[model samples]
Target: MSVKPESASELFSGPFALGTFSAASGPAFPGLIDREGQVLDLRTALSDPALTMRGLLERWSAVLPQLRELASSSEPVRRPLEELRVLAPVEPRQIFQSGANYRQHVIDLHVAHRAPDDDRPEEERRAEAAEIMDRRAAEDLPYVFIGLPSSVTGPYDDVTLPAWAAKPDWELELVAVIGRPAHQVSVEEALEYVAGYTIANDLTDRATVFRRDMPQIGTDWLRSKNAPGFTPLGPWIVPAESIGDTGDLQLTLKLNGEVMQDESTKDMIFDVARMVAYASQTARLLPGDLVLTGSPAGNGMHWGRLLRDGDVMDASITGLGAQRTRCLAEES
Candidate 1:
C-alpha cells in the first residue's frame, strides 16, 4: 500500500520532513517532503547537487531555514511523492539500541517468560518484576548496545527471515537522529544534540538471543539482531522542533492487520534524553547517528505470536512517519 499525505499528516505534525527518494533506476537523492504530498528534489534545490541526507544533517542548523522556506514556497521542481521510491532517511555511522528500558514491557516479559520450574503465582511474579524495574530505574544505568549499520533497510523493503531463525520478532522503536557532535553531554543537554526523529522496526531472531552453550556470556545481541535488512528505518525524518513532546508520543505496530503492539513513550523507564546522554558518556555522537529508544509492551513474544513468512508489519510513531515492512522466508 502506498503512503498517503493526508494519512501521514495526521501522525506527522511537521510542516516538512527530510527523506531519501529515487526514481525507478536512478540513484537516491535527498528530498524535502511537504504536507501536500510533494517532494522537492534537494539535489537541484541545494547548492550541492551531491548532498546526501547525512551531509544535510551535518549542516542541519544552517540548512534548516532554507528547507523551511523551500517547503513553504511553490517549488516548481517538486514531484509527486508516490512517483519516487522512498529509502531509509539517513545512513548512520553508528547505531545505539536501548534494551529493556520500557517499564511495562519488562514487567510483561518477566511474567510471560517465567521459568518453567518456577510455579509462582502470577501476581507474585508481577510484583517482583515491578520492584526490580523500580529499583533499576532509580539506580542502574540504561542498557545500551551497538547495532550494525549494514542491517539497515528502507521502510517499505522486504525482510528475509533467515532459515535458521526459528522464531523472529518485531520491535518497533522511536529513533533519535543526532545532528551535532556530542561527547559526555548531560541529560539536560542531550535533546539539543538531536536534530530529528524517525521510526525503526528492530527485527530480531528470538532463537539466537541467548547463548545456551555459554550461559555465562549472557545475551548474544549480535547474532540475534544484526542481520542484513533487520532494521527497517524511516519513511522520513521529522525535525525535533516540530515534535512537541517526545515523552508522550504513541507507538503502535500492526502485524498482518492485527494490532500486536500498542503503547506510549511515557511507559519508557528512561526517556530519550537519558538514553542519548548515557550513550554519549562512552562514545561521541556524530551527525546522522541513531539512538533507538527501547520498544514498549505488547511484543510478539509477550503474545506468544511470532513472525511468519509473508507477514506485514506497519509501525508508526507520533510526529514521525510510519514504516511498512513485508517478511519473506529465506530459500533453503
Candidate 2:
C-alpha cells in the first residue's frame, strides 16, 4: 500500500483505456488508445458535421450503430491509423496542465511540502503528512497551466530542442479528455462529465521545477514545461464508455525497454471525478479540452536525471496506450 505514485492504478481504469486511436491522414480525429501506442479508428462517429456539443450523450456505445452505417457506405477512400500522422486528441481552444499531484513524487524529488501553517510548530509535521493525501488529490486539480496550440505532437514523435537550451526532460502522464461542455460542477458529477483518456509526457527543465519553493517555480513550470514538442500526446482517445474506471491500471515508462518509472493510477491522491469537478468551478471545459494529470518524480529533469540526445523515452499509462519518442538535438 505504500508504493510510489508510479505504481498505483487507482485512476486509470476504463474501456477506452484498453485501445488506441486513428483518423484521416491530414487532420486529427478522436478514437481509442490501443495496446501498443496506436489509435483505433472511430470512423465517422466523430466526423459528424451535425454532431452537437450538447446531446443525449448517454453512453459511448450509443453511437456505434451510426458509425457502422457510415463506415460501410464510404464512397471515398478511408484512412488507416498506421498510415496517417497522429495528433493530440483534444483541440481545446486553450490548454491546462497540473503540478504537485503525487506523494512519493514530492519526497523523492525533494519538493518541499509547502503548506499554510509551517509557522505553527504543531502543524509543521502534520502539514507534511497531509501531502500524502494531497499528492493523490492534486492530480485531479492540475493547477491549470497554459500552453501553445502549435506545440503539441503525436505518439512516437520526437521530443527535440535547440542545443543552447538549459535543460529538457520527460514526465510520463495521463491526459483527461472532456466529453462535454461544463462549468461549475461537483466531484460527484466528474466521471459522468468526461469524454475519454489519453497519454502525455509533461517534460520539464531542471532549472524550472526546483527553484526555492516560491513563485519562481510557477514561472518555470509553464515555460520549461511548454516548449515545442514538450507535450507528446495521442496514439488514441478511447471513449470513456469503452474504458471503465481509469483509476485501476498499470503504468510504466521504460528507457529502451528497461523500466525507469512504473506505477498505477490508484496512487493518484486526486481521482478523476474531483479533477473535472474542481476545474469547472473556475474555467469552462469543452469537448476537446485536455487535462494533463501530473507526473511522478522519476522524470529526467531532476538533478542528475536529465535527458540526453538519442535517448529513447517510452511512456505508457495503463489502458491509454504507450508513446515512444526519441530525444533529438536541433540542427545548427
Candidate 3:
C-alpha cells in the first residue's frame, strides 16, 4: 500500500540529495537524485554495483566531490525518478533517540499524564512543568535511548498497527546522519561529525511505554518502539553544509491531511550537538549511525487522537525531505 507523492522533487531540497532506489523489482542501489527529478545510478556511475548508501557515507569525503561533478554534468545513464521505488536512504547500524528533548512537548506530557487524583489547576501544572524543564535544561544531561535498526522501513511503506497497540502515536523527528567517527566528542565539534540530515517518524505504542509489571525497571522503549517498520526514515539525505542552521528547521506531521504536529527545531531543550555529543560519550558514533533529536510539541497523546487503521501520515523536515506512510491493522 505505497502511496506515491505528487512530485518527489517537491519533497527534497537543494541541487541534489542522496537516496537508495530500485528499478523493476531489482536490487537496491545508491542513487543521486537531482532537482530535475532524475536519478543517476551511483552503482553504475561509481563503477561499483554493490555499493550501498551506508558504504558511500563511510567514504563521504572522497565521494561527495565526485557526486557534485556528476550532478552538474549531463549523465547518459540517468533514469526518470518516477520509474523507481525509493527505499530508506541509509541503513544505520545504530540509532540513538533523544527523549523529552523538546521543551513544550515535555510540559504537555507532564500536564496531560498527571495523576487522576491530583486536582491542581491546569495553569499551575503547566507552570510547574515549565520550571522543571528549565532546571533540567540548565543542569541535567540529555536522555537518550537505543533503537533497533531492524525497526526501520521505507519512507512510503505501510506501517502495521499491532492489534495489542491500543494507542499508537507518531513522533516525527529530525535525524542527523553521522559521517565521521566520533567517540567522546565535545558539543562544539559534534556538528562536524554529522554528514547530512533526514526525516524519521518515531512511531510509538503509548500503551506499552511503561511496564506495569516491573515498575522499578521504568520505561520500556524496546517494547514500545522497536516493532518492525516502527521507524519510517528518509526520502533522501540533504548534506549538512546545504542546511546552514540546524536550530531553525521546521518539522511538520499531517495525519490524513490535517496538520497535527507543526513545530520548530528551536524548541529543542537539548540541541543536535548536545544529543550527539552525549551519545558519543557512551558509544562510538560511526558513519551511517543516526542521532534522532526528540520530537516537538504536538503528538497523539497531547491531542488525545491516536492512530487508526488506514490513517495516512505525511511527515517532513525543513530541507531534509518528506515521508508518506500509510497505517494498516495487523491481522490476527
Candidate 4:
C-alpha cells in the first residue's frame, strides 16, 4: 500500500501521528500522519514553509492545537506514508537515560549472576532488592547519564556493531521528547515540558560497561553505548495528550521473533515525572531533548544472550508504534 496525494481537500478524517521523514525529494522533514498511513505535509498544511520535528517541538505550545485542528479539517496537503523515509522523530540536543530504574529487572540480573561465596535463595535476593527499590523510589534521586546525539538513527535503520565490542545489548524504552525549556522544574509540572513520546532502543556494548583499570569511575557509557546508530528511535511520535496513563503502557522487545523483554512501565522505580524533573535540576532541557525512561526487565544481560550480526530487533510500546532494527558487524 502506498500513499498518492489526490487533492488538498482530502485530509485525514480523524486523529493522526507525527514525526520526521524524508519525502520524495528533500532532506529529513516533519509531518502529520493518520492511522491509515497517510501523511499531511506540515510545511504546506501549517503554512510554516520550514518545519522539522525539531521546529514543531520548539513551538509545541502554539503548534499542537493547530496541528490537531488541521488534521480534523479537509484542506491540508496530503500524501501517502509510503512516499517517505522515516527518520528519528527528533534529533535531540541532549539525551538523558535513566539507569537501574526497574526493580524486577535489577533483581533478575542479581539473581542470574549470584556470587559463588554468597549463598542465598533467589527469593531472598529478590525481596532484598525490592525493599531497596521501594525506599529508593520514595527517597533517592534517579540515576541518569548523558548520551550523545550522534548515536541516534532512524527506527528502521541498521545497527552497526563496533569491532571492539564483544557483547551488544538492547534496552527498549519509552522516550519523552521535550517541548519547552525546563530548568529546576517541580515534579508536578514536569510533564508539561514534554511535547510527545516515542520509542528508543538504547543499544549498549555490554563488555565495555566496566573498566578494570578505572573501577572507581564505574561505567563508561560513552564508549559502551555511543556507537553510530546505537540509539534506534521512533516510527512516529504520539502527541502527549493522546497517551493515557504513561505508567501503564506495556514495553516489549523481540529478537529474531522471540519475545525477550516484556513488562509494563508501572514497574519503573521512578516514573516519568520524577525522571524529567530530576534531569531539569542539573541542566536546562531544551526542545527536542530526549529522556529515555529506563527499560523493563529481560535484557540480554539477564537472558545470557547478546546481539550478533544479522540479528533483527522488533520493539513496540502501546500506541506509540514499533521499530525494527537489523544488526551488522562493522566491516574490516
Number of the top lDDT candidate: 3
Q: Which sections of candidate 3 miss by over 4 Å?
A: none
lDDT of 2 by residue, 86-165 (tens): 45544455566766565556554543333445455535555565665575454444455666655677667777865655
Please give, for residues 263-331, the per-residue lDDT of candidate 1 as tens digits.
999899999999999999999999999999999998888899999888889888888878888889999
List the global CA lDDT of all models.
Answer: 0.89, 0.59, 0.91, 0.84
How much is 86 displaced in model 2, in angstroms? Answer: 2.9
Q: Give stretches of model 2 more than 4 Å off.
A: 1-80, 111-142, 210-218, 301-303
Candidate 2 structure, TM-score to reference: 0.72
Candidate closer to the true structure by lDDT (higher is better), 1 or 3: 3
Please give, for residues 1-332, the per-residue lDDT of candidate 3 as tens digits.
68786575755666789999998869999899888889999998999888999999999888889988998988747888889998999999999999999999999988877877989999999999999989988896799999999999999999999998989999999999999899999999999999999999999998899888987999999999999999999999998888878888899999999999999999999889999999999999999999999999899999999999999999998897788999999999
Please name the candidate that would achieve the greatest TM-score relative to the true structure. Answer: 3
For every candidate in turn, the CA RMSD to the true structure comes to 1.9, 7.7, 1.1, 4.2
Q: Give the TM-score of candidate 1.
A: 0.96
Q: List the residue pairs that clash in candidate 1.
A: none
- TM-score of model 3 (CA atoms): 0.98
**Better TM-score candidate (3, 4):** 3
